[model samples]
Target: MEKILVVEDDKDIRDILKIYLKTGFFEIWEAENGKQAFEVLENKEPDLVILDLMLPDINGLDICKNIRIKYKYPIIMITAKTSDQDKIAGLTYGADDYITKPFNPLEVLARVKAQLRRYKEYWKGSNEKNTIYYKGLILDRNSMHVNLNGINLKLTPTEFKLLEILLLNKGQVLSGEKLFHLLREDEYYSKSTNTITVHIRNLREKMKESFERPEYIKTVWGVGYIIED
Candidate 1:
């Protein structure tokens, strides 16, 4: 059975998730704070992480940053903060997905399953001719390997997905809503264009392109985004 680590400060929420995830047949571990979360990490590796954005002992973003520096596990950030900035901050720190609080348990389960599937895909290499080329950019979707100008760059999965979509559709405009749908592996996450905006910023940073005059992924003001053919 796949294991899941649930980190939240509220006992009631934690308990509910424990029962809910157990019903999904996941071997669940619970932690009330980042301290306990690390202890749990030392003991066992989980297939996915459902992390609260705020923790009493340690800021959840710090934990996410710390973990991503060494591990590539899929992290789904959960928080009460609904602002786009807050969600972007979590994503900037390496969270694979985000969910706002007062969340539906069913949505959480769907995201959990989606993240685990993506995790497996990241490691096991999908059986597709995923190496795609556009201009000087190269991407091997199966291994999530990416290169540009013959120089390799490290990219988070979120950035990879964004750039992959843009590359695949070269010259065709893709709306933020369409991008969100393609990026989300499940149907639970909010269809917020702001999420795409933040991710686009991150992708530009990794691609070493200035947002004011991007070399790729041109923003068509009042429309969407596209890359020239």
Candidate 2:
């Protein structure tokens, strides 16, 4: 059974989510504050987290940032805030998806199912016992590790997925639109090319490549982006 930690301050909402999610396949956990959430994370390491932005102890973004530092588990931010800034902030902090309050229970369940399915597929590929190399970088798909210039590089889940797509189609020019669609398929709610650009920029920075003169991911000037030699 897949375990999930639901962190929300509202007793009614928490109970509602728990009851709906407790069908035979899922083991549900609950926390009303950021502090308790962290404790649950340390001990249980649930397969997914349904997090709320407003917590009594600490900001939910802070918790998300802290968790991203050590863990790559899927996080779905459930909050009342529907602003684009809030959505982007949550994603930037490593959330896999964001759902506004007043959301349908079935919709939330669908999103949860989608995220878990994609995450499982990613890891299953990574465990293939084969390594893929391109542009001086090696991706151990099975271990979910990347090596650049013989030094291991730490990548967020989004970054790893982006690189995997680009590298797998090495030298092929993938437009931002196509990349955005691919990313959205994984539950990232990015609606514009800007989001893809931001993630790619971050990836380049982590790969120690200069944006002014990127070595691997090069902009095609109105065409999209591609991994270049």
Best by TM-score: 1
Global lDDT of each candidate: 0.84, 0.81
Residue 88 Cα positional deviation in candidate 1, in Å, after optimal superposition: 1.7
RMSD to native, candidate 1: 2.2
Worst 10 residues of 1 by lDDT: 185-194
Per-residue lDDT, model 2, residue 206, is: 79
Give lDDT tens digits, candidate 1, residues 1-229. 9989999999999988888888889998899999999998887888888999989999999988988776677889999998878998999988888889998888788888877776576566556667888778899887777899998867777778788889878889999888888777556665555778888887788788887899888999978899889
Residue 91, model 1: lDDT of: 91
For residue 3, what is the lDDT in candidate 2? Answer: 88
Candidate 2 TM-score, C-alpha based: 0.85
Model 1: runs farther than 4 Å from truth? 123-127
lDDT of 2 by residue, 9-103 (tens): 99999888887787536889999999899888887788888999988889999998888888877889988997878877887777767788988
- lDDT against true structure, model 2: 0.81
What's the CA RMSD for each of the models? 2.2, 2.8
